[model samples]
Target chain A: MTAATQPQRTGRVRRVGERQEALAGYAFIAVPMALFLVLNIGTTLYAFFISVWDWNVRTGPRSFLGLGNFERLLNDDIFLIAVKNSLYYTVIWVPLTMAIGLFLAVIVNQKIRGRTFFRAAFYFPAIASSAAITILWIFLVQPGGLFDEIRGALGLNPLFAAMGYGPTHNWMGDPATAMNSIIILNAWTTSGTFMLFYLAALQSISNDVYEAAAIDGAGAWQTFWRVTFPLLRPGHFFVATVGVIGALQLFDQVRIGGGPNGDPNNALMSVVLYLYNAAFIQVNLDYAAAVGVVLFLVIFAAPLVQRRIFGSGPAW
Target chain B: MSTDPPAAAQRPPRAAVDQLAGRIPSLAETEDVGPVGDRSRAWRKRIAYALMIGYALLMFVPFAWTVITSFKTRADALRLEVIPDPFTLQGWEYTFARLDPSIVTLFINSALIATAVTVTNLVLGSLGGYAFARLRFPGREVLFVVVLATLMIPDQLRLVPVYVLFNNFGLTRDVGQYIGVILVLAISATSIFLLRQYFLSIPKDLEEAARIDGAGFFTTFYRVMLPLATPALAAVTILQFQGTWNGFFWPVILLRDRDHYTIPIGLLFFRESGGFSTNWPPLMAVVVIATIPILILYIFFQRYFVEGVAASGVKG
Candidate 1:
């Protein structure tokens, strides 16, 4: 009779302990989850709700628009321009940044001298604030500045003139060059980060794969393309997805470089910058909320689109 | 000895094994290769080094130019000179003494807000991370997925609503602005996910052992888990601090008063109010000052920064 009671008592004690553990788990996540719900999820739902209303700070929810704001966005030239510029920037910047990053990673991954210094130097620009970098970039690209000096020294000004793009163009002031200038800056600043990603991926590849390639008498180019690149599929997917998401939200440099109105013909205007201008500068909260929703959809759709193209499974 | 010679001859050469391991076999190891191959390899190495050096220099020129420009007089700053001619500290003096809102004020505000945000993230992230990593509460997987799904939703989507929400709460004004910004960034999905990933990597035996010794959930986490999570905590600290310090978008929206402006917004204000086209030197000086703290952090904690970035890229 005592032995029979012992199992039952132990089972009850185990259940009690589990109850306490569950309580502790809930307690641990309580503050953070509450903050996340109110700030992240709550704000997101509020954005959707306000998108249908004409919200004004003074009067609050002045009128119900019922998708009118989103419809208006379709006809808005500045909004279209902003969208086009963001897509253009992403298409060019993402590939350029990833390529440069991969190249640097490959070089640094080699058992060569001063690779650590090279890695650190490449990553330096990434650590600085975008505002600071943009300020520096403005000076670098100013008329008769370092870029112009280099253009003149390289005899590239005449080449540009011959191509009808004009010689000695103002990099940040000219509509034709302003967006490109921002793209160049973005790539320069971000490529080192992608380089670190690629380096980690490279380090993880097993030596046996290289051994197999060597046994097959594969040349360096063939080995890289056939073996290394395929092995880095996961890294490629991560970089591309993150890159697209980040690129779509381009604002700080553009805002600083071109001002809130996206000066010099709105060439540097991005979707996020437009959202900012709408909400704060123009004081149209409802319209801005609609813009915010569209931006979210676009950013959300990017990875799905990438996954479909890349054939997704586990990323790592 | 005769049997050993045959067995050894049947095995692959040491040089071949090294080559297979992805190392470039040394000259003596590859004696069968001709001079043509050697020359080509040498040329390839030279080209690789040249490309790396060239890119590194290109990446660094803007920074070097910014430093030079800051030391130059306004007139001298306009030129494309490599070095400052007749260098002076007028720009630095003007920035420190004459700039409204003052460099000191901006620095302090940024430091205060970033520190508060970093500490909050570390505490909350670890709690949530620990619960998700070790606890067996109902709905854990779904809740964790919810946390991750929030990451895909761009911040711009929530910007307008978050702004309006805080504005309604009167949190976008003066001291309340600090509360608003801190609340928005206090805990991030990335931080929780990172810490969770880190915790998951640790052996479960440690926590299990603590539990067996009659330690409760909180005690096990605090005593057995937290101390072992130092590396992850450091990574989270660096990433969060850098992110908050350089944050611009939310602060620009939330902080209406000049007194509460962070470094990025302050830099923007300085640029616009200083009449950037004419006052290049002092603006550059301000940029330099704004960047130094992050640069110093990156220098000292370079490994943590790189590891944090790589871990995020791989596991995020």
Candidate 2:
């Protein structure tokens, strides 16, 4: 009888302990969950709600639009330009940065000296503030600055001149070059980060695979293209997805480089920059919310598109 | 295990095997076409080194130029000299003295805000991550999914609504702006996700042992788990600090007063105030100032930074 009672008491105690554990779990997540609901989920839902209404701080919900703002955005010239520029930046910058990163990673992965120094040098720009980097970029690309000096020294001014861009072409001030300049700056700042990712991926591939390729008489180029490239599939997918998402959110550089309105005919204008201008500078909160919703859709669709392109695999 | 053949007896004799292998021409030795292959390999190495060095220099030139320009006078900065001719501290002096609210104030604000945000993320992220990782409770999977979903939504999507929300709460002013920024950045999905991933990778035995000893849930987490998660905590701290230190968008929007402006916003204001005939030297000086702290952090905590990026598999 005493043994039976002991078992029952222990079971009851275990149940009480389980209840306490559950309570603790709820308590642990309480603050973050609350903040996430209020800040992230709440704000996201609010954004969607306001997108359908003509809302502003001063007067609040002036009228209901019911997708009217999105329709207006579709027809808006600046919005289209912003979208085009964002796409252009993504298309060019993502591949360029990834290639540079992969190349650097491969180089650094080789058993060589000073690889750490080289890695650090390449990554330094990435750690710097974007605003600071953009400011420096503005100075670097100024007419007759270091770039022009290098162009003159390399005897490439004539090539530029033949292409209708003079040696002294204002990189940030020219519509043709403004977006490209921003892309170059971003590539410089981000490639090192992607390089690190690619390096990690490369290091995970064992030497046995390389030896197997070598035994098959594959040349260095062939081995890289056949064995290494395919093996970096996961890295490619990750870099591409993250790059696309980040490129679409380009704002700090454009804002600093081209002003609040993307100067030189909105060439540097990005979707996020447009959203900012719409909300704060223009004080059109509802329109900005609409733009935000559209940007969100594009950002959401990007990874799904990538997933399709890369295909689901065990590595993923 | 002891019942198996002795370790040495279980394997072929090493010297005999080596001798047998040496009798046959190894793939590497057989493939070596004497001088031709050696010369070609040497050439490849040389080419690889050249390409890497060239790219590294390209990656570093802008920064090198920024540093050089910072030492030059206004007129000297515009010159095409690689070295600063007639170097001066005028730029640094001007940055400290002439900037509204002063550079020191900007640094303090950035440090304070970043510290607060990092600390909150460490505390809340660990708690949430611990619960999601080790604690069993209803809605665990759903809540984890919700946290990840938040990561997909771009900050721009929530910008307008969050701004309006803050404005309504009277948080878009002075110290309130700091509080607002902290609140928004307090506990990121990335932080929770990273910590959760780390916590999940830890063995269950430790927590189980603590539980069997009659330690409460909070005590086990605080005593046994938190101390064991130092590496993950370090990663989160560095990532959060760097992110907040360099953050531009929210600060630019929320912090209107110069006194409350973070470094990025201050840099933007400095650039914009220069207008058409911008003072490049002084501006570069401020850029250097803004970049130095992050550079120092990266140099010292380089491992943690790379680990953070690898762990998150996302851009900071």
lDDT of 2 by residue, B23-76 (tens): 222223335667888877677667867877887788778878888888899878
lDDT of 2 by residue, A55-143 (tens): 96866898889999999999999999999999999999999999989987777665466867888877777888889889888888888
Leading candidate by DockQ: 1
| Candidate 1 chain B minimal-lDDT segment of 10 residues | B1-10
Candidate 2's TM-score: 0.92
What DockQ does predicted model 1 obtain?
0.43
Model 2 chain B: weakest 10-residue lDDT segment is: B1-10
Q: State residue A25's C-alpha deviation in candidate 2, in Å.
A: 0.9
Candidates in order have lDDT scores of: 0.85, 0.85
The C-alpha TM-scores of every prediction are: 0.93, 0.92
B71, model 2: CA deviation in Å? 1.4
DockQ-based class of model 1 = acceptable
